[model samples]
Target chain A: MSEKFSLSIEDLHVSYQLSGSAGKNKIARAVDGVSLQLHPGETLALVGESGSGKTSIANAVMRLLEPTSGKILLDGVDLVPLQGSELRAMRRNFQMIFQDPFESLDPRQRVIETVMEPLEIHGIGENQEQRRDLALAALAQAGLRPAADIGDRFTHQLSGGQRQRVAIASAIILKPSLIIADEPVSMLDVSLRAGILRVMADLRDQLGVSYLFITHDLSLAWMFADRIAVIYLGRIVEEASAVDLIENPMHPYTKALVSVIPVPEAIEGASRTILSGEIPSPSSIPSGCRFHPRCPLFRELGEPEKCLNEDPLLQISAKSESHLVACFFSDPSKGDTQ
Target chain B: MSLLEIRDLHVSYPNRKGEFFAVDGVDLTIEQGEFVGLAGESGCGKTTLALSIPQLLPEHSRIAAGSISFNGVDTTALNEEGLRAIRWKEISVIFQGALNALNPVQTIGSQIQEPIRIHDESVSKKEAQDRTLELLEAVGIPSHRASDFPHQFSGGMRQRVMIAMALSCMPKLVIADEPITALDVMTQAQILDLLRSLCDKYKLSMLLISHDLSVLAQTCDRVAVMYAGKVAEQGPTSRVFGSVGAQHPYTQRLLRAYPNIRHERKFIDGIPGYPPDLSTLQVGCRFADRCDVALSRCATEVPDLIDIGGNQSVACHLVSENQVGVQ
Candidate 1:
């Protein structure tokens, strides 16, 4: 059972209390009853725009933010109840890679020191020399050749791609079974981002590591992830295989997102579904569907009265075992049946 | 005649070790009512080139050579007073980092009104306020929200305010440097659509600078690929990124790196090496070290921009030699 999956999040809810101008507090449900599962060596991308709780989900999983309630089961062991040394020991099984490599790494620390910090903190290596050797090996594995020379230089001395490689080395040095990467290559140049993606994919293949890859860019997720979960507001709106999600999106939000992505091809006369308004604030999330206000399909479907009252739960498609969507109007038998 | 022309422009900043050439020998032109895009990675001198057009370079930077002509007027030779007259009146810039660019304490209305008032003293305060409301409405923001401060607005609204401010005077040309870089996908699409529509409505020539190639392809009529402070390729967007693909090795590599939603999934090949250090002068092509199609002569002889017909040009020795043989 649960051991088959690398990480499983059950009914996760992360809320924050914000004080208003009048000193009254309001609860912001960043991650509202979200659930996901990542198998061994699989990449599950949580895709969404800002304020969509993608990063909140990652933070909650990483234990950087405490969740209001949820069960985070890693290898059949519940992580929420762990504390002190037990939690510290559990951290080695899960690691995180942040968005901006320049800011993530300490400027004063050398590359070797940055990567070795995790090993030293966890008391993995017996001696400093052994730790240095392991750090250099991880750097080599991360595609930074002449690892000794690279290890001697400070983070500022390296290029953006190289700095990201260092970040990856640090994350993989612990050989974590799961890596929570939050927009890991978003800050790097387009020419440089592909290299980092290749490195991560290669590392996953070699180390059998799963990833909770969270990003705003759907194209990147489509390129790398095994499965894609589209989140809107604070809930999973759609989930499917990468190919299925991109080729045939069932949810209106996912369809709009897919259409808006700027493809390299000319795509002449391709009609784009432009949503009218910006994402609403999390504190005052819209009632019912949560996306009804800006959903173009909501109007196209003749303004379903049910969308304004009853929220749809995520349901597995009858056509396919893997595809799941949380929309009342998205009938699985409509088009491209599986 | 061209709306704007930059010939052999050289801009540098004084570092501890002599001058660092942020924008080396570069030549570019924008036709009237044309939308041109400048695409490059960070530190590739795209921003420096845009800043040089408006004489808005930072304090330590110096214009080392060449001239910038706007509507046949040599902008580089203009005096301070003359340049100020042409800045917001003839050309305006929508700077990057829209959130920090707007003043926090001031209302969006006042900031949009600043340019309108400064450029024309004849315009009254009431008139300027009316024009601010008009500009806000044009950029898709509500006119009533003009009184709201920047912090009250979302990221997308702040960007719309920036666009409104740039359109306040209705200059002949607009230079937007990474306007939608920090925004989300939906917000980015909205801004792009607004920019395209606004450009059409006003018939304004635009220089849209961004590191994202897909963005450039979506917005611009022509695209110039910049690398290591130089234009590696320049052509119509259709030909530059057409079925045949970009001719310059760097341009092709860059285009290949981006994941196209229309295309099937495949492993994207990344450019292997880092960009050359700007301070150290190189004899041959700056991209020779990382280029896979580099010939032996690429390390010794610099390649000049060669016209490859169909309004497309490339600065690669291999491409130029192949074109010569075909001719």
Candidate 2:
């Protein structure tokens, strides 16, 4: 365990047992042996398609769902074993921002009440007055100017962007060490998305808050995240700096995912690698290399038997220590591998 | 000849306070086999404008003035029965949210065949089924799975089914409203490719409505940027999105907000403040409150869409004045 890291997940595994109609038992490995580390004030984005277990990892870290096996360590404390008041106490160190601001925020609660509820639940301030003052300051920090006026309006009265600002205000009011934002801007309009992203970035710089930003938009991940982790099914297929991942993606899935992102400028004669089929269900995960069924490179390599027999571990590349890829065929030294 | 021409079209709905213009004075035209995209934020009335094309507005809503001319015919003056003649035979719609648009209790084939049967009663059941199979295959869905229910398919597959349904009647113009919004990036690309190819093969005109500027930039031949029920800018996709130049500050801001993979990290400035309320009377520019380069006159004078040559038009006092001076 590194002391420099603010949050670390060691071999996290979350599974759900399901009973079939014929009384057969099956296990869905939502988070299958995933591990990640986030430095203080660092932004790490988990980019994947839906049903790729990104939300499950966030849920496990928030202690909303129990992990079958793994260590969720925040500041050297293993949160997997913590429960009751201890878990509640640990929750104060981390907060979450959800996708839909309208659904996440209570319609009846005013902006001030929503932001102050966190402080009240944690029993941080002495009374309502102090909490209200802190909430107002947080609102201003979130770029909602004239905080007192904006704080008086209810969630329904505010725009989608304003509601999201309120949500950010609530998340940062606690001054948590880490914030897990799940598609925070996906629900908002395209123009409003950048504003929320900027707020999150500024908060990290000012308060030294780390972020585990989960989103399906890879382009957004490239724009904001310092480090990008591409997840497939329940495992991290590739993890590298944003620049490295976007410019030099190694995993076959990462390459395909990056190729499909619609850029504003049309690159003439640019051929895209479109994967053939949808992501397989978590309950029926393929054996060996999980992505081998849809791996265009694997088929191009004459159906390598090794990919069908051995599952690849996420291994650091020889070129860069920070760049890791979970594929045997992604050796950058070989010119033909890419 | 233009396939669809909307001139100063205004749609309004009465509320507790008064009538609110959802689709205010807007002029748009789509040539034969042209793909025109309408891009805007939510509640900016892009959907309302698209819905008004087929006269699908709600009961409370009414077309206040102007005209919608399709194929040299005035569509706004058509009655329900008259409109039905052109609805599926000439124009069709692929609505948002494929999951809800499809009926769960019915098979995909039946839903697709309904349009074909309604449009042309002479077609036999077997021929309709064959056409349904062909439509399904065209959308990249396996023909054997035509009997499958909506729930049996993936999100992308359901979207394909929706496209297949929209194309069953072979309409000349298809209005696709956010066809791939919720799907993954890969699926979105596939859907867009399918749409482009289908439009080309059928020589069909399309009106694609989405909040995503990148999607519009990639798909549409020409783009119309709407803000608060007005067309802020309209031009060729290359000029509007590419370096040729975007005249409107709103369009520029929208283009900047989207992260382009080809470009390096650039500062994205969000347009401050929410869109102005539609129910309230507006005398000047709707985007003046958020416009960074707005002049004092901008708050008092509403600018009309002015042509800046090269098939580009803008509705901003700043850009129009600059262009007029240059000319």
Collision count for each candidate, in order: 0, 0
Looking at model 1 chain B, report the run of 10 residues with the lowest lDDT sum.
Answer: B237-246
After TM-score superposition, the amount by which residue A117's alpha carbon in candidate 1 deviates from its true location, in angstroms, is: 2.3
Output the worst ten-in-a-row residue range by lDDT, candidate 1 chain A: A329-338
Off-target runs (Cα >4 Å) in candidate 2 are A20-24, A334-338, B16-18
- Residue lDDT tens for model 2, B198-280: 99988999999988887887888999999999999999888877767678999888878888778886656677778898999
- Between which residue pairs do clashes occur in model 1? none
Per-residue lDDT for A239-325 in model 1, tens only?
999989999898999999999888765657778988989998888888889999998878987878878878888889766889999
Write candidate 2's Cα lDDT for A159-239 as tens digits.
888899999999999899999999999988877888899999999999999999999999889888999999999999999
lDDT of 1 by residue, B34-104 (tens): 99999987889999999999899999898999999999999999989999998888999999886688899
Candidate 2: lDDT of B264?
A: 84
**Local error of candidate 1 at B47, Å?**
1.1
Q: What residue runs in model 1 are displaced by over 4 Å at the alpha carbon? A: A1-3, A332-338, B15-20
- TM-score of every model versus the real structure: 0.97, 0.96
